[model samples]
Structures are given as C-alpha cells and as structure tokens.
Target: MWSSKYSEDIKEKVLEMYLHGEANVEKISKRYGIPASTIKNWISLYWEEEQARAERSKAASRRKRRFVNGKELRVVRPTSGSAYIDWRRK
Candidate 1:
C-alpha cells in the first residue's frame, strides 16, 4: 500500500477551511488533491482531539474548586513526569 504524508500545518489549514464553511469535502479534495475520505478522517480526528481537550479542562477546573476551612483552595497539577497525585486538600 502507498501512503502520503501530509504535514500538520497542511492538515490544520484544510480542516479550518472545511470548518469555516468555505468549502465542502469534495471541493476541498479536488482543490488540495487529497481524497474526500482522507479529508473526512482528518476532520474527525481534529474533533476528537478538541473534545478530549475540553474534557481535560473541565476536569481540571473541577479539581481547582475545593473548600478548606471555609476558604477556597486551588489545586495544582504538575505538568510533567508525573501521572499520579493525591488531590485531597489539607
């Protein structure tokens, strides 16, 4: 099977064009010389990532709102090298 490698920048631009109502999948496929199915796959992947990011932000915000001694405490998560945390506020 032959595969074509498209850079992230090109994928993002094509998805943006489709999302902004500037063109349909068929037209975009023709213009960019990409298959309609490939374009659709890119759009689907973009939406999945976006939904995951939204969910992560929501969970982080929920974790941030904690009460201790009638005072709100902010929870901070380390951004690197650690996946486990005891989020209980002391």
Candidate 2:
C-alpha cells in the first residue's frame, strides 16, 4: 500500500507535469504506479489552481491600470532591464 505522505508528493509532481501540458493522467499513473482516477483528480486540482492564478494575474493587471482604492504596491522587476513596475498594465 502507498503511504499518504509519499502519495502527496507524487501527486504534486504528476500534477505539475500535467499542468505544464507535457503528460496526461494515464501516463503519469503508469509512471508513478498510481491509479488513473487519482491522477485525474490531481490534474483537476492543478487546473483549478492554474485558473485561479490566471484570474489573479488578470486582476492584478486591471488593478495596475488604474489608481484604485489606495492599494499599496511593491514594484519588482519581472525581467532584466524591465525595471518598470506594473508594466503588464501597459
């Protein structure tokens, strides 16, 4: 029987590859000796998180576009020489 602790880590790695569009659930399950259904569940959770992240990024961009509700912001360079903060809003 697989332990919950190890299964959790395996689930993370499986979901990572799935989210990156590299592997499907069946392949991941075969590689990890886990069930396809479990892999599918993990993939679903990963996609949900990915969607949430995309939503957050969209919201952040929208917020950066307009001076709203006195939100405190910290500027960080997303790339080298891209020193302008909130450049995504542009």
Candidate 3:
C-alpha cells in the first residue's frame, strides 16, 4: 500500500499548536492543508509518545541508585517475589 510521508518538523509544529491551545484540529488542518483526521492521528501519536517518554523517565529514575551515608543504595524487586528489598540491607 502507498503511504504519504510528512516531515518530522511539520508533525511537531502541528502537535505543538494543538497542545498549546493555539488552534483546534479543524483550524490547524485548514491552515496546514492537512485532513482533520490526519491531524487527529498526529495529535494522538504525539500524546502517546509523550506518555511513553514520561514512563521511561520514571523507570530510569527508579533504576538509579541513591547515595546515603557514603553507601549506594538501590531498591530491587525480585523476579519471583512481590516484595521489594533495599540492596544495602542485604
């Protein structure tokens, strides 16, 4: 199947405009000459990407160890157990 390709910059701008309340989907579509459905898809895609990025950052922070009393401590979850353990305690 043939598909249309749009530049990343245009996608970002369209999403930014919508998210920032600068314009609604219909207005943006008219201004950009893109279909309303296409604009909605871009908005949804941008929102999902933002959510995934947030989740990744949270997971990364959870994985990082903290320094306390000159010792690095990490919170670890066992694969076979539901309990959480502090690495410094064991």
Best prediction by lDDT: 3
Considering only N, C-alpha and C atoms within 3 Å, which residue pairs clash in candidate 2? none
Model 3, 16-37: lDDT tens digits are 8999999999999999899999
Model 2 CA lDDT for position 35? 88
Q: Higher lDDT: candidate 2 or 3?
A: 3
Q: Would you give me the overall lDDT of model 1? A: 0.78
**lDDT of every model, 2 decimals:** 0.78, 0.69, 0.79
- Tell me model 3's lDDT, rounded to 2 decimals: 0.79
Off by more than 4 A, model 2: 1-8, 17-23, 64-90
For candidate 3, give the lDDT of residue 73. 79
Which portions of model 1 miss their true places by more than 4 Å?
1-4, 64-90
lDDT of 2 by residue, 1-90 (tens): 233545666666876788788887788888888888877766666678779999999998886434335544447778877775442321
Give the poorly placed runs of model 3, Cα more than 4 Å off. Answer: 1-4, 64-90
lDDT of 1 by residue, 1-90 (tens): 113598777787798899999999999999989889999988888789889999999997776466777665653457765554344545
lDDT of 2 at 39: 71
Q: Which TM-score value belongs to model 3? A: 0.64
Q: Candidate 3: deviation at residue 76, Å?
A: 16
